[model samples]
Target: MLTYNLSNIGSDSLYEHLYKCIKKDIVLRKIKPGERLPSKRTFAKNLGISVITVENAYSLLMSEGFIYSLPKKGFYVADLNDVQPTKQVHQETVVLTSGHTHYLADFSSNQTESEIFPFTTWIKTMKEVLKDNQKELMINSPCGGILELRKNIATFLKEFRDMDVKPEQIIIGAGTEYLYSLIIQLLGNDIKYGLENPGYPKTAQIYKSMNVHFEYVNMDSYGIDPQELERKDIDVIHISPSHQFPTGIVMPISRRYELLGWANKVKNHYIIEDDYDSELRLGGKPLPTLQSIDVSDKVIYMNTFTKTLSSTIRMSYMVLPESLANEYYKRLSFYSCTVSNFEQYTLSKFIENGHFERHINRLRNYYQKKQEIILNAFQSSVLKNKVEIYNESAGVHFLMKIKSKKEEKEIINNAYSKGIKLNPLSKYYSNSIENNNIYVMNYSSLNSNKIEEIVEKLKQCI
Candidate 1:
């Protein structure tokens, strides 16, 4: 018979406590391999607990391969001789990583602020999903994603971005990076890709890893120059028209049409509209998406929840052109959906319940206030006369032109040594360029309270 002091179960339920206790004993060799466990009823009576508790514990143990059972016989501990003995780890000794340096201010990361996250709302929606969507959760999502999520997203795009897209056109993926690979596969590798110069580096990194032919397309004032794309003879161009990264250039309506015209000129031409971080547009009405204006079926629209929700969510999606959508199913239908059914269903409920929009409204207000506070801090800080801020109208980050004689690299390295992480604007450029003293001020996850301290530290570095 298994012996456990059930009186001190603490926060755990009757079955959970029993399960952990039994598992620990089995792991420690107190319950030897092939040793029979008392029947559920006998164990329950001995422990003064319900038989259901013992049964559940036994079932859990069996499911985890810690124990086995024979029909019409009894439960027996499974052989764990090959498994190493569990070692107790001290809390203080268990560091997640070695030599991990903590930064006072990480201006390079565009991670969402944890304080603004609607944890209570998200948790409630998730719980509701677990209770109401047990069946749907078990069902395998289609290669694109669950219909529920896609449908909600479709409706959202229509109302928010004025894009008329069918749910069938949306293909959900783990992240924008994952979807980029899918795009390369969908549109053969032979074609040349025109990437925005001084844009997000991750896109270029993805293309390089895939060994695809690509060139850096220089950007004019409007955005990625269509003339540059034509000059490069590029078949595919990746762009962030709504709000260009680092530069924060929102492509004008004229530019959007010009790019679409260029795409229409070539039979194989396609524009990957990476509309990342458009939701957090700080001021004025949200600009229309390129997909909403696209008529030539040349746009492959992509967006992610990482901006509005959390970065760890790993949920992103793309809207394929009608023809491309058909082709995707014909060619890539065998690929199972990358996101889990539970997440898909939970997001669907989040959107359907109006929590997403409300959260967005609240977030926008919070970020607007936060951005003001940080900008004001910089303006009033000791570095007030030494810094020039630009492109603070939209997005979570802006371009900061630091008035310094030191090179960008030197300034960045010195700042890092002082516990400040500064990402230089030149790092996004593919070709080598002289130091401009410009840095990308990503304040999404910045601690506003530490702004004064950071400015003082940065003063020492610059």
Candidate 2:
């Protein structure tokens, strides 16, 4: 008999819960193949659920090939020989999943200070848009994006990033992941992609899930080794040259030019420039974007407003080359923009009214102070002798090389035992880089007062 205690399945829809329970039994062969299922009326009466609920659950299962029904008879379980049960992964990783323990001072987030957001200004802008632009909000943005938001982004880019970007060249999406998928689709899967080792793992994970061919390109102090790029058959290279993630190595002009020269070597070569946090460069003069320097139309520039604005805002934009822009329209013109019109218009107003610049400035100052407090505490801590500040050039994170007599696993274990949840530099790498003592610390969301507590714990552990 189908057993479902609906009262205990809190937070799930009744029909959904029924569907899932039945599906699980079918998959596990508890309800064997070809076994008859109770009719909707009978099942509803037995379970004390509405007949429509039972019908909905059966319909879902039948639609999904989990069950089949005869015209005059009840439903029968479909053959689920192809349905394999998922296995648990026992491999050890420094990933911050639900499996990882909690912490007092979590330093593994790139989330901006939510307290610093201009909520009043944003609410006011949103209201203004809703009042006058209700029709615009109801409709979808164009294939690329709304003209107003794209134009403002272009202007912002030219002013802040020194990129000679046109509005039509910009493609707005929900976030970097969506934009990345679009990029893969636009560029075609035939090309070999090169991702930076010891870089953002999410990019690699996305590529893998899409079943695309990609390799890890090793990096140096300058950036991805130009020689390594030249030797590989990689047709596309995704990088954050302005300020490389995890490493924080800002590529110099020589390296930038060298990269451009390398991209020009092969016909149809492209460089995906992930300038994620360029505006948050807390130190040194802001360098021109890689796309700004590329005359060959090789660089694809991407950025988002999450770090400067709010994490909840999922708007991320990309600038395609002129030729590729036309190509994208020809192939993907039917695809609507991922960002909603309300958000697009609101963000446009935010940028157009100079509030965006102010927000970035305020966040830069705020994070600079936060970074200083954390860094100062680390320097003045008892564990300072064992830890060396590696890179503090850009973004809210800096690398620290821990010099300890203990093994890497033991050191990490000790830190975890002390309730210091964190990750080793090895966590980000995909085989090209060797991880020894380096670790990444993102203090953007860490409270100022918790620094001493974390440092004291680390001192005791390290």
My TM-score estimates for the predictions, one after another, are: 0.78, 0.78
Colliding pairs, model 1:
none
Off by over 4 Å in 1: 1-101
Clashing pairs in 2: none
Indicate the residue-level lDDT of 402 in model 2: 87
- Poorly placed runs, candidate 2 (over 4 Å): 1-102, 432-435
Each model's total of backbone clashes: 0, 0
Candidate models: Cα lDDT each: 0.87, 0.83
